[model samples]
Target chain A: MNLMSAISVALLALRVNLLRSVLAMLGIIIGVSAVIAMVSVTEGAKRAMEERIASFGANLLVIRPGSSAFGGRRGGAGTATFLTDADVEAIRSEIPGIVAVSGEMSGSQPMVVAGENWTTNVQGVHSDYFEARDWFVESGRAFTPAEVRSGARVIMIGQTVATELFGAAGPLGQTVRVGAVPMEVIGIMAPKGQSSWGSDQDDTVFAPITTARSRLFGYQFGVRDPVFTIYAEVAPGTNVSHAVADIEELLRVRRNIQPGAEDDFSVNNLAEFIRARNETETQLGVLLAAAAVISLLVGGIGIMNIMLVSVTERTREIGLRLAVGARRADVRNQFLIESVVLCVTGGIAGMAIGVAGAYGIGNLGDFPVSIHPAIAGIAIGAAVFVGLFFGFYPAHRASRLDPIEALRFE
Target chain B: MAAPLIECRDLTRVYRMGGGEVRALDGVSLTIDEGEYVAIMGASGSGKSTFMNLLGALDRPTSGSLKVAGEAIETMGPDQLAAFRNRTIGFVFQQFNLLARTSAEDNAALPLIYSGLKGAERRERARARLQQVGLGERMDHHPSQLSGGQQQRVAIARALVNNPRILLADEPTGALDSQTTVEVLGIFDRLNAEGITVILVTHEQDVADHARRQIVFRDGRIVEDRR
Candidate 1:
């Protein structure tokens, strides 16, 4: 049959059962909409994490104290022994491609200022700590070399501490008791809010490495056992693996570890963290895609069910057309067109609903939402394919019907 | 002087039922000329309908040769037969086979769909045919809206739309009142006068009396050939 007749017949079929057509198409709409919406929300979450990761300077590399475990319980809180100041000096003096290295020893400490006390994390580090972590002191001044040499009792408060301890007056050049030790506040750090790990990073304090070592932990190099963790930042264009190997070699030599002995130190980078997160996102994407596929199958089943009923209903019509000179192919084409039209229409409706759903979720989530063209294209293309694939058997059945038998049927 | 438009030699059709073979048409031979209004008359189960079906190319003969419009239909595939039927034969059914919810014009244009005419051209031709069948004012009206005689007229117009060489009608007036039957017969007479070969199947004597020639069949064979 010609294009005109095929289209007219399909239109007539739809018009005849407007409500049934809509109901049949609802399945496809829901399937496509759910797929698109779930994918969009998951993609949005992934993008948000990537952006947070990006905010931390890409050049920065963190030197923690343990190897990253695979599928094991997370390494946290005293499992990895605290690294010492000697480790930091050894990397600075001996290791090549090491730009800025600072040993950090952070712990939560109760602070009091005029009886207004709030607990906050206390980071003890050298002057290079700011440059190493890419953070800056927003007020007063960071600890100087003279203060580190003298082991002066001066501290740098974070924004949250400044606000809680000093109120509206600001805490520059004030004194706050750090665990019953009165330390003069020298600097205040800019707010960094929560880290990507969801830790309250801003509610913390900073102090010189010497003061924290001598006063808080009560240790001084070999004479007293010292406990401090080290953070090292690799230089630009330096291979992190090479830097890590170099640091390991230097530490092994400095600590006098024998050859073939296991070294007790760990170096981590942003790349590893990003890779883990990416793998997690990839799994999520696959899960969502699989769910979408299942829904599409359900939609296709719905279409097939409806088309089979249509074939049964139009049995006499098929017979009459055959008797009046319609070929089997023509009969098949008519039904196929009907099925495709139903799906395409459903796809369009699904797109609308999906887009609206995405917008609603994006606003409710308070995160960025991306509506990419490739997603819409995939949805529509998938819908059409589902329609055609599922609609085939019914159309074939209609076309293969015997004209004589069909005509004789009531 | 000219070769007959329809010719069948020992045409036979068999049906398989309940693990047994039932011959619907044993062996039938017939010939029909152009512009002839012929009727195949018989009671129920006399194989008259089967013979008509084979003649119209709506069914394939299980055995024997059948030809319509000088083409041997016995050797043709379903697709080829469909094309041949579209090109050379028109069918009128016992119940007017007009599509429900479709305009009379569209119903008439159904056969032309196989001819691959454009929408406008098809509609125009359908309109002209409907007007010729005295349904000019009811071109856009649906089958349910029209009377039985009007519906049959639309079916007849659909049959003639392709300008087939032969019109094969099965029980054209079987469901109609005498008045409507006479009206349908008047339209058929007019068509036969216009040199369209008309073959009608009917048991009603008054319906058969309208035809220029008639044939009686018994047990799948022509019992009497009267002209």
Candidate 2:
């Protein structure tokens, strides 16, 4: 038969047994939609991570004290806290690519202002810490270099803190009292959203490290001239690894560490951090893709099974067609078209459901889900391939039957 | 004279069973001219059905020259045989064999589907044949909705849809009641009288008696021929 008639006949056959045809297509639907939903969600998460890495200054290197052992007990990272002001100053003066360096101390405390009390994160840093972190004041000014020599009781409030402590009145020129100490809000820091680690970046108050050490957390750590963490921003067109090595060498020399002894400090760069996270995400993406492939395979086998049953059930009809002069190729094309039409229809439905499912999951769980236009083409192509691969044997069998024997079949 | 619609010479069909062979049609030769109403009668396994299969070009003979419409059917390939059947032979089966859930027009037009005809032309030819068989009013009725007599008539219309050289009927009335059988046989008589060659293969003597010529087979060979 001609192509048009063959297609029409296949469609008619499928319509004749509508329930069975849909049931046969179910495996393909589930398989395709599951893959699509999983793939889009994975893509969404990867993009989110990349954007988060970009949000923070990409060239910032975080320097902190390494773990220390005392009396056979090893302490956690940053517990040693041997980093001093001399080491920070030497790095600031010594490193060539160090555009900005700031030594910071942070603590969590409740601040009260005019009968309003809110517990939030507080950071103590040099004024240049804003430049290192790519964070700047939206209004007012940062404290100057002279403020470090004589501790100043001044603070800059983050967007969240300003909103919490002063409501719509704004926190600029207001007094935020921490325990018995009162610090004036010199600035409102620009807004920064959630960090990659799922913490709010805008819920902090910034003060000078000299003031924080002499006034608030000095009693807690019991250290003199304590500078635990240092943020160093590398200039554009500078090699970060070389700068990191230079800082490590300068720190070792200033701290009087001999050659071949393990350094007491550790440097963590943002690129390495992102690489580690991406490795884990790539592994997860592969796992999800494998599951999707398997589901498609199972769907293909379902088509094969249903096509076989259909061929057997219609043996007599096949005989009648052959007797009426339908070529063997014509018979084969009819069954092939039926299978392809089944999968293509199922695949389209599956794509719609998958995108909807991805969005539904995204809304419910507060995660990202991105759907690419190319995924639809892939779904349809995969479905046609599956139909052809699985439907061939049954169509061949139908075409090879002996017309006389088939007609006589009960 | 024009070539006979069907010609057979030394026609034989052999089937192999476990360690044995059964000759279904053994060296039987026959000719059927155009515009003849002929019946070949025999009991089950008497080779009447085998002969009909060869005459319709549905089965190849083991050794013979069988021609239909001036083409040597036994020497034809599978595709050629299919085209030969489409253009030259029409078949009516004992069970009617009308596709269920299909309208009478579509069922009758089945042969034209393989003839490379378009939908409009196929429907037109099928319509004419259905009207010829007196089923013009019920053209849209499905097989399930038609009576046994009407169903058989629909099958007859399907047989004539291709305007073939001969109509091959294999126990065409076997599934019908006595009244329906009479009605179906009457349609066949009218078609044959209109200059279309008809071959009826059955064991019922009364059914064979309606034809102008009768040939009886026994043990894969013809035992009697009467005109």
Candidate 3:
């Protein structure tokens, strides 16, 4: 049969059972919609995690203190005895891909700024910390290397602190109290939204390492010499895994670990972090795809069932067509095309509904939803395959019909 | 002037009925020349329908050779037989088996479509065929909307769309009124005059009389051949 005739016949048959076709398509719509929605939510989650991991910079590596014991406590005491500024400097100098590194000392306290006070966390770091973390001042200038050297009480506040301290008025070059100590806020960092870990990442202030080490707690080695996490940036285009390996070796050697002794440090790179996030996302994606496939399978079974009924109902018609000179292939093609047309139409409609449903869920809920083109293509392709696979029996039966027997069929 | 258009030698059709056998056609042999309007007359159980089915390539003879338009029927597969039927023969039925849901134009267009004509050309041919069958104004009408005579005329137009070498009418006027039957018979007479090979299968004498020659079957065998 010509393409036009095939299309017309398929369309005419679909039109003849318009209500049934729509219902069948609704199954596909729900299936595809679930696929799109699930993928969107998972993709949004992936993006959220990646953004949090990325805020540390593409070449950034986070070094956290690994497992440690103190006085046989054998549990976390909000401090670990391992990581230090020397380790950070050693990595920066020895690691080939490492460009800059900084150790963080975190302290949370109520800060009073110009008669307004709010409780916020403060992190003390070297001057190179801004470059290593890809953080820059949104207003005014960051604390200079000289200020960090002199242990000057200069600080950089996040946008949230700036807003709370000065309201609509500018807070650049203002003074804020940090644990009964006054510090100069030379700059305000730009707003970084909520992290996947449910923390407002920018709701804090940054102070010079010397001042935080000397002025606030009065001693450096007070609590098992535990400070904060160390962050370092590697050079661009450098293999992160290689950098991680090099950093691990350097830390092990510096810490003077004996052979077969476990190192007391952890190095996390962008690739591993992103891989971890993607692994979770991929699991969720598979789950969503399976659900969509189940619905599509059910829809396919429904089509097969309905087609079998159609074949039985049109037995005499089939005989008449065969008797009137229709080739078996023609009959086969006609039914095959009908099945495909139904599925394709259902797929399209389902995709549309899925997109709409995704958008609705995204807007109505806190979950982020985004429609991806690859997912839509996959859903539709799967739907078509399901249609063809399940539709075979009925189409074959119709095509193999003996005209004499079919005519005689009641 | 030439070989017969259809030739059958000892054609037989056997049906297996629960370990027993029934012969629908037994050793039937016949030849039909081009442009010959011949009728195959028989009672309800005389196997005329079986003979028509065999002659139309809708069924294969269980034994013996049957050739139509120089093609061997027994050797042809289902697909080949279907193509041969589409290309070389047009069948009319007693029930005027028009597709119920299709319009008259679409029904007529079916054969042309099977012949691989494009939609525009098929529609044009269908339109002309319907017009020839006096359904010009009823092209869009469904078979259910048409009278029995009109439906039969549409069926005839559908049969004629591919310009087949032979027109096989199996009780073509059996379901029509006498007046409608006469009108339909006039169509066959006109088609015969135009030198198209026409084969009519009927039990009615008047319907059989319209053909130039007659063959009568009884108990699955042709008992009389008259011209």
Candidate 4:
């Protein structure tokens, strides 16, 4: 018989045993749905991780002094600190890809404002700090370059510090007492939310580096000039490795480190860190996808099991058809068609359910998901494969049945 | 003279039952001409059913030659034999064997599907045969909705719809009442009268009596062939 007629006959047969057919295809249904949902969910997580990576400063590099990367250390990590503003200037002048650079002097300080006191982290920075951090004034203006040179009493308060210290009344132009010195809040920073490590990023205060050095913290205990770290933002579309090489060479020359002598600083590439995290996440996604495919395989086995039962149950019918005139090929094709129909139909249903389930997961949780159109084709292919794989043996058995015996079967 | 519609020469069938073999139809020979109505009768395991299966091309003989319409049945492959059966033979069963829940018309047209005829022609041919069997009005009725005799009539219609040269019935009326038996036998008689060769397998003397020729089998061989 032609394939079209065989398919129609198969459809008719499945419809006759509608409930049993559905039950038989249930494994394929769950498998396809799981695969689609799992893939979409993994993709969603990857994108979420990418977003967090971007927020974690994808283009920013942190330069820490006195790191263990310098070999022959006398004391600990802070023992070899010799970072200077002149070294920072040489980097700013020498590096081609550096868009912004800031010398940081950070300390946890107890501050009081209008009878309210809060202990908050405070960083001393350059005028370029806002751009380097991708932070902007949500309401007020930032400190000028002149303020850093003059050790200005101006400060920038983060959203958390602003809320905690001032509440409903805004903190702009308010006086905050640090130790015995008072500084005016010049800007309320745009909220930065949480860091990739889950720390509240919007809980710090910012002031001019010179002001931090002379007023509140005196000098960084182990580092020269009270500056402990430097932050650099690479220009967009520029290769960062070359910039790192140039900065390292320039810093080595400025610090008078000879060849074969280990340097006192470490330039940490944030992208490498994010890439490592992303690789781990992608590997996990692959694992999840494999599990989904396994379930689909299990579903195929279910189809095979049910198809065998169907052949056994309809032995007499098979005998009657053979007695009428159906060839063995015709019989085999009919059953194969039936098995394929069951899988393909179930696969389609699973795709619909999976797409809906994926989006539902996205909406119900923090993870975001997207449907890939290729999944439709993949699902159908998988269904056909499963149908053929699990169906062939049963169909062969049905076709091989002796008409005389089958017809005599009760 | 045209060739006999069916001819068998030393036809034998053996079944491998566990260790030893059972000679089901041992060294049997028979012939039936066109336009003849014949009945084969035997007790259970007397090989009458086995002979019918061989005649219907549903089983292969272990030895000797059996021919239908001059085509050797022994040498034909499975697919070729299936096609031969489709084109040359029509079969009826005791239980009607009509697919349940299918309308009488579709049941009658079942054989035509193998003939590769499209729906409209198959339905038309089936419709005419149903009418021929006096079941034209009940064409839409399912097997459950029809009486035993009517169901047998539908089976007759299905058997004749293919316009086969030979009509093989294996206890076609075995499940029916005496009244329905008479009604079904009448249709076979009428079809035989219309120049179609009819072969039936039965143990009932009265059922065998309807045929123009009767053959009796005992111990896997034909013991009697009489008019």
lDDT of each: 0.82, 0.87, 0.83, 0.86
Estimate, for each residue in B75-180, the C-alpha lDDT of model 4 and write its tens digit.
9988888888888889999988888878999889888888899989999999999999899899999999999899989988888888899999999989999998
Clashes of 4: 1
What is the two-chain DockQ of model 4?
0.53
Question: In model 1, which residue pairs have backbone atoms overlapping below 3 Å?
Answer: none
Ranking by TM-score: 3, 2, 1, 4
TM-score per candidate, in order? 0.78, 0.78, 0.87, 0.75
Interface RMSD of 1: 1.0
Model 3 vs truth, CA RMSD = 3.8
Q: Give candidate 3's whole-model lDDT.
A: 0.83
Q: How much is the lDDT of residue B181 in candidate 3? A: 97
Q: Residue A12 CA error for candidate 3 (Å)?
A: 2.0
Cα distance off (Å), candidate 1, residue A65: 4.5
Tens digits of per-residue lDDT for model 2, A1-410? 77777777888888888998899888888878877888888888888777776667768888877642222324555445467777778888999989989899888878999999998878889887888888999998888888877889999988999898899996788888975689999999899898877789999999898988888775755455777788898998899999989998888887677899777777778766876777766676687778778888899999999999999999999999999998899888889988998888889888888899889978987768889898899779878988998999999999999889888877
Candidate 3's error at A201, in angstroms? Answer: 2.3
Look at candidate 3 and give me any clashing residue pairs.
Answer: A29-A350
DockQ of every predicted complex:
0.60, 0.65, 0.69, 0.53
List ranges where model 1 is wrong by over 4 Å. Answer: A2-5, A57-60, A65-194, A197-250, A258-263, A274-290, A359-369
Which CAPRI category fits model 3? Answer: medium
Clashing pairs in 4: A220-A226
Model 1 lDDT tens row, A1-410: 77766877897898899999998988888888877877787777677666666555555566655444332334554554556676777778887777788877767789998979999888778887787777888888888878876888999887878888888986887888998799999888877777777777678888887777667766434433243556677787888888878877876676566898665555567756775776765676688678778888888899999999999988988988898788999999899988988888888898889879888977985645667777778677878798889999999999999987787767
Fraction of real interface contacts that model 3 preserves: 0.72
